[model samples]
Target: MKKLSMIAAMLSLLVSTGSQAMGPFEVYEQALRNDPVFLGALKERDAGQENRAIGRAGLLPRISYNYNQGRNDSKATYLNERGNLHEDRHYTSSGSTLMLQQPLIDYEAYANYRKGVAQALFADETFRGKSQELLVRVLTYYTQALFAQDQIEIAQASKKAYEEQFQQNEQLFRQGEGTRTDILEAESRFELATAEEIEARNEQDAALRELGALIGVPSVAVSELAPLAQAFQSFPLEPANFDTWHALALANNPILASQRQALEVARYEVERNRAGHLPKLNAYASVRKSESDSGNTYNQRYDTNTIGLEVNVPLFAGGGVSASVRQASANLEQAEYELDGKTRETLIELRRQFSACLSGVSKLRAYQKALNSAEALVVSTKQSILGGERVNLDALNAEQQLYSTRRDLAQARYDYLMAWTKLHYYAGTLRETDLARVDEAFVRR
Candidate 1:
C-alpha cells in the first residue's frame, strides 16, 4: 500500500509540474498583452487619436483675454489763443478686453478635420495589422520549437535502438556467433546517433530560448505542443476566383486601407491649399480706461469702448499658394497610384497563400498515409526478426525509414497548421477568437 501511495504521489507531482509549462497559443496571448512591439503600436494609435482631436479643434471657437497697464510722463495741450502749452504731468492708463473668434466659414478647417478622421481610422487599422503580424511570428516560432522537439525525440529513439543493437552484437561476439565487424558497425552507428541526439537537443534549446525572449518571459520552458488534430479539418480549400479574392483584398487588407486613407488625406490637403486663396473675415471689440491728474476735465477717470470688423484678402502670395496647390495635387495622384499598387500586390499574396494552404493540406494527407505504412513496415520487420529470420542491415534500414517517415509526418502536420493560419490571416478572419480556440486546444487538462 505504501508503494502504491508513493507511485500515486509521484504521478501527481509530474502532473502538477507539467501544468506549469505554457503552450504555443498561451505564449501568443501573453506576448500580445505584454510584447514591446504591440505596446508601441498601441501607443501610436493613441497618438493618432490625439492628432484627430487637435485637428478637430481647428474648427471650434477660440476665446482669449488681454490686459494692459502703463504709466506715462506727458504734457497737457489746450486749444487756446497760444495754440498749445506743455506742462509737467503723469498719467496712468489701464485696460482689459475679451475676444472670441469662431470659424464661421473656414474651408481649410473642414478639410483638415476630414483628413484627421481618415488618419485616425488608418491608425486603428495599422494597429490591428501589427497585432496580426505579431501573432504570425509567434505561431512560426512556436511551430519551429515543436519541430525541434520532434527531431530530438526521433534522435533519442534512434540512439536507444542503436545502443540495444550494440549490446546484442556484443553478446553474440562473446558467444562467437557474430563477427567483430558487426560490433564495430553497431558502435559507429551508436556514436553517430549520439551526436545527432546532441545536435537535436541543442537546436531545441535554442528555439525555446528564442520563443521565451519573444514572449517577454525569457525563463519559460516549453514542454510540448498539442498534436495537430481536428482543428484543421474544416479549413476551406475552394480556390476563390482571382476577381473575388482581389475584391476582398482591396476591401480587407490593412495596407490597402491605409493607402486609401492616405489618398483621402492628400485630396483634402489639396482642398486646404486651395482655401488659402480665399478671403478671411473676423470681428473684434475692446474697452479702454485712463486717469489724469492735471487735465481740465469733469472727472479724473475716462473710458472708451469700440467694436469693428476686419477682412483679409489674399490678393497675391508670390505664387506660393499656387505652388502649394500643385504640390498637393501631385501628392494626391501619387497616393492614388500607390493604393492601386498595394491592392494588386495584396491580391497576388492572397492567391499565393491560398495555393500554399491547399498544397499543405494535400501533403498532410499523403504524409499521414505514409506514416501508417511506415509503422506497419516496422512492426512487420520486428515480427520477422523474432521469427528466427537473421536480422541484417535491412532491419536497420527499415527502422531508419520509419523514423524519417514519422518526422516528415510531424512536419507536414505543422506545415498544414501554419498554412491554415496564413490563409485565415490573409482573409482577415484570424481574430482573437481564433487565437482563443488555439489556446483551448493547447491548454493542459
Candidate 2:
C-alpha cells in the first residue's frame, strides 16, 4: 500500500509539473535567439560594413609596378655615296622595364566611395527590419500554439461530459427506464467526443512541434498559455491619424531608409559617370634596360629612366560617357519613385493595422458577452437534464456551443494581441524594451 501510494503521488506531481511549465513567450524568445534568418541578417550586416570600409579606402592613391622582357630581330638596307647597296645585319634585342603609376585626380572613385558608405547605412537599417519581421513570425506561431492548447482543453472537457452521459444512459437502459436508442445515442456521442479529443491532441502536438522548429529548439517543451486576463490586463489605445503613422513609418522603417539610400547611390553613380568626361591626371615613373647582339657583329646595352605626370583628356568616346550618365540619371529617378511608392504603401498598411486593432477590441467585447450567454445556456440545460426532462441532447448541444463560444473568445483575444503588435511595429515602437512589456502582459507564472 505504501509503495502504491508513493507511485501515485509521484505521478500526480509529474502531471502538475507538466501542466504549469514554461509559457509561450519564453519559447518565442528562445526561438528568436536561435533563428537562422535573424542570424543570417546579422552576418549580412557585418559583411556590408566591411564593404563600406573597402569603399572608404578607395579615396586613397593607388600604386602599381610592371616589368617586361622581349627579343627582336630585324634587317635594314643602307645606300652609300658609291651607289653600292650594303645590307645591314639582323640583330636581336631584349629589354625589360619597371613602371609605377598612381591616379592624381579621379572624380568617379570619390563618388563611388561615398555611395558605398550610404549603402552600409542602408544595410544596418535592413538588419533592424529583419529583426522586426522575425518578431512577428515568432509571435504569430506562439499564439497559434496557445490556441491549439485551448482546443485540447475544450476537447478534454467535452470528452469527459460525453463519457459521463453515456454511463448514465447505459444504467438507465439496463434498468428499463431508458430506451436502447437513448443508450446508443449517448454511446455514439461519447465516441464522437473521443475522436475529436484524439484529433485535438494530435493538432496540439503538431503545433508544439512547429513552434519548436521555429524557435530552433526541437527538444524544448511548451507549457500552456496563460489565461487571457493575465495576457491583456490593460489596453493601451491612442488616437492618431494616418499621417502620424506614415511619419513614424517613414522615419523608422528600414526598407524606406534603404530606398532613400539607394537613391543617393544612384545619384552618385550619375556623378561618377559624368566624371568620365573630365580629364584624369596620373603620376608615373619607369626604368628600362635593353641589350642587342648581331651575329658576329656587335653588342649594345642601354638603360633609361623617366618620371612625369600624365593627363588624359577624354576628347570623345563615341558618346558612351553621355549615355552612361543618362542611364544613371534614369536609375536615380526610378529609385526616387520606389521610395515614394513604399512610403505610400507603408502608410496604407499602418492604417489597416490600426483599423484592425480597433475592430478586434470591439469583437473581443462581443465575444465576452457571447461566452457568458453560452455558459448560462449550458448551466440551464444541465439543470433540465437533472430534473428528469428529456434534455440530454439539448445539454450536449449547449456544451458544444459553449466550447465554440470559448474558442471564438480565445481567437478574438489572439487577434487583438496580433493587431496590437502590428500597430506598434508600424509605429516604430517595436523594440527589445517593448518586448519586455509584452512579456509582462502575456507571460504568466
Best by TM-score: 1
Give the TM-score comparing model 1 with the true structure, all chains together: 0.77
The parts of candidate 2 lying over 4 Å away from their true place are 1-33, 67-105, 165-207, 224-231, 238-243, 283-307, 315-334, 385-390, 443-445
State in Å the error of residue 307, model 1. 5.2
Clashing residue pairs in candidate 1 (N, C-alpha, C atoms within 3 angstroms): none
Q: Report the C-alpha lDDT of model 2 over 384-414, residue by residue, as the tens digit.
A: 8788774577877887788888888888888
* lDDT (Cα atoms) of all candidates against the true structure: 0.71, 0.72
**Local lDDT at 102 for model 2:** 72
Give the TM-score of each candidate.
Answer: 0.77, 0.75
RMSD of each: 7.5, 8.0
